[model samples]
Target chain A: MRVVREIALHVFKESVRDRVPYTLVFFAVLLMATSYLLGQLTAGQEVKIIKDLGLAATSLIGLFIAIFIGIGLVSKEVERRSIYNLLSKPVSRRQVVLGKYLGLVLTLLVNISVMVAALYGVLAYFWFVSDPSVKAGWETPALDPALMVASGLIFVELALITALALVFSTFSSPLLSAALTFGLFIVGHFNADLKRFDQIVASRPVAYLARALYYLLPNLTLFDVKAEVVHGYHVPATAVVSAVGYAAAYIAVLVATSVFIFERRDFK
Target chain B: MPAIRTEALTKDYSTGFWRPRPSRALENLTLEIAPGEIFGFLGPNGAGKTTTLKLLMQLIFPTSGRAEILGRPVGDVGVKRRLGYLPENPYFYDNLTAEELLVYYARVFGHHGSEAARRAGELLDLVGIGGERALQLRKFSKGMLQRIGLAQALLNDPDVVFLDEPMSGLDPLGRRDVRELILRLRERGCTVFFSSHILSDAESLCSRVAILSAGRLIATGTVSELLAFGVGGWELVMTNLAAATVARLGLRIARATEIAEGHYALELPIDAAPDGLLRELTAAGAALVSLNPIRPTLEDVFIKKVGGARERATFHHGAHRDHREKT
Candidate 1:
């Protein structure tokens, strides 16, 4: 466990020092400022506009970070031949895989937290000067507590995406890992539609394969309650719970596969 | 018990993506090093020296056979606590400073905070990098990185230290410092198993050495045992003499080399007596400075063994292939 912590801390330190994450977060914050300015252009719709744009920025930045940084975690170490020294220590490959996954997840969490804070800052400023507490289209207040629920699910989704990226990273090149991971992210979002493919497609074999893939593929739509949360509508607690549970299961499978591959990988 | 032991250990790498072929990287390597011995693993490039080291370090799994360190199986976590390894051409994290990198590795070995910091500082000074502890690794030179790599390997006060090409990427002074450090470790009863092409260092330091060629062990013995043949001949140095004087004495100087004006270095034949030469030098107004025997070196032994192996392997493996062909 200590070995895992050390590796994790090392990864976190490496990620913090890299310029990519900072650059992405800077852009996310820039988008937040853009959201604020765009909100000012509308009448009585500033709060929703800000929330919508803010969440989008968070999701997009989180996705990019999850793919780019996450894909390089193991592959970069291998390419640099640094993993040789680390593996020579008193640690197992399983521990290394877990540590890498957790560390990147920590980095993603911190970046998402920063983006969410920037969004709230925009909302707070609007509340301070305009004092527009209109509840016309909103089911909740201007400063909705349910917004955290949406962000938390975004984090869970990012965590799962990070695990996917890590799994690809353990065996493939960073470029290939990035391409596969981003492709999986795109597929994960649309797998929910695959569950109902039997109604749209007449071919029995295609429908069966789609149904099997629906169960196999990650149902990322379960995590995106952005619409309800943005509109300040009531998001059920059950939805968040199920999504969290699903993420845990998916991440476990991906991480176990990563460990299995890494254990057998030659550093030569 | 031996601090390190391997029993017919072997490794075959699967090459070719679509149709895998078993290419032997290390073949039936068997070895044992007693505790506190400075054992040198000597081999030419691609003679499976690094492969053997990696197998013992458990960085790569063996295809067959077994190995043990400190009576525990290879890859055992508890055994690794007592073991340290420095890879060939070691690469550390570029963002980390010497202090942070050492502290981080210390934490990997279970030390934390001030203890880790203390170990890092001690190692920095030990490796002569204390002043540069705070500097980032990216700015460091190759030799500096090698020093840091040595520091991290010693962080645990390990019972057995494995160093692959420990003298690589360093100046003579750096190599001397590392040699002294290895001596220090041996003084503290740490078994040092290092692989190096620099046989001169091995000849000076190692208690015993194993020579590998073509993925196989060709020789293993103490320095003296392998160099059992007596000194070849005598080399005599003298001054204030011309080459014509030596030609007159019927003193058959096997080889005569000039040192300076009116000075000469002379090599005597193996069976030739030095007594008459000394007398003749003094009578001929020449001063005899020194007489020394030329002993055979490890390089002589290495070339002989590798050369012999290549001749034998030519029939089976092929004549075109060098014995130390890259894996």
Candidate 2:
């Protein structure tokens, strides 16, 4: 466990020094700031516009960072031939996979926090400085604590994506791993549609295949409470608990499979 | 018990897309290194020296074989705590300074905080790179990189150190420093197993050596044992001898060159007895200047074991031979 943490800390140090994560974070903050400008044009709906666009920007930028950096976490090490130095240590392959995953997740967490804080700042600035009549007529407070629920879910979703990218990176090249992880991210969000199609499809074989895919792919849409929180509707406690549980379970499976594959690999 | 041992170890890599064939990187390599001996693995490029090191390090799995380090299987992670390896042309994390990189490795070995930092500093100093602690690995020279690599390999004070081409890419002085370091390790009773194509260094530094050719062990012995195994030729010189008289002696002269004024030097075979040749020279009225029996060097033994000079000429690129040998 200590070894895993050391590896994690080392990877974190290495990753934070890279320009890619910093660049992504810069764009993410810019997009959140742009949402404030877009909010200004919405007139009476400034708060709603800011909330919706801010959450969307946060998730979108988080996805890019998770997928791009996560794919290269191990693949880059192998390509640069640095894996030789890393693997020759007393640490096991399992520890390496876990450490890299945790390290990137930490990076994503910091970036996500920055975006979230910036979005909240924009919303707060509009709430306090806007016309007095406009502030009185607003239904929800600008600094809504409920927004954190959505951000938390996005964080969980990003963690799952990061774990999946690591699993692909264990055996595939960086390009292939990126493609596969992004494909799963897209397909995962629409898993409910696959189940719905199974109910309406005419052919038995097609229905069975659709049902299988529904269970196989992650239901990422479950984690999106942005619409509820943005519209000032209460997101139920049960929903948040379930989403967190699902993300945890899925990440566990992905990391375990990655460890198994990595342990058997011959760094040839 | 031997500090290191392998039983018919072999590694075969599959290649090609459609008509793939298995390229054997190492074949039935059975060898041993006793405790407290500096064992040298000598081979040209494309030999199985690095492959053997990889197998012992568990960087790659053997196709069919077993290896033991410190009386445990190669894959035993616990055994690695006492084992250190320096790969050929190592590539380390470029983002890290020497101090940070060493601290990270030290942490991996269960050291942390000031202790890890102290150990890291000590190792860097030991490798003669102590002054470069603040510099990132990216800015280092090749020799500096090799030195840092050696320091990291010794982070845990390993009982057995496996160095693949430790002398490669170093200046003559750097090479001398590494050779002396290896000697120091052996003096401290650390089993140092290193591979190199530089036979001269191996001849001077190693207590025993194994010469590998085409993924196979061709020769294995002490420096003296290998050199004395073959009877080398002889050298002879004559002064003030007439060309006609020298020709009349009827000796198989390896080479005959004029030395000083009216003096000639001749190289002869070991089978050509000096007494008979001396009598012939005297009868022919030729003055004998000098007669000496030549001793073979490791270079000669290597060329002989690896199918002579022609094969040695093309032995540097192992990957290229890996393909050709497959077909």
lDDT to native, each model: 0.88, 0.86
Q: Per-prediction DockQ scores?
A: 0.75, 0.63
Per-candidate TM vs. native? 0.94, 0.88
Instruction: Indicate the docking level reached by candidate 2.
Output: medium
Give me candidate 1's TM-score against the actual structure: 0.94
Q: Kindly list the per-residue Cα lDDT of model 1 for residues B32-103, writing each as its tens digit.
A: 999999999999999999998888888889999999999989888888888889999999888888899999
Model 2 segments more than 4 A misplaced: A24-40, B18-20, B234-293, B308-327
Error of 2 at A88 (Å): 1.7
- Listed for every candidate in order, the interface RMSD values in angstroms are 1.0, 1.1
Model 2: colliding residue pairs: B46-B318
Report model 2's TM-score to 2 decimal places: 0.88
Docking class of 1: medium
Quote the positional error of residue B303 for candidate 1 in Å: 1.6
In terms of lDDT, the poorest run of 10 residues in model 2 chain A is A19-28
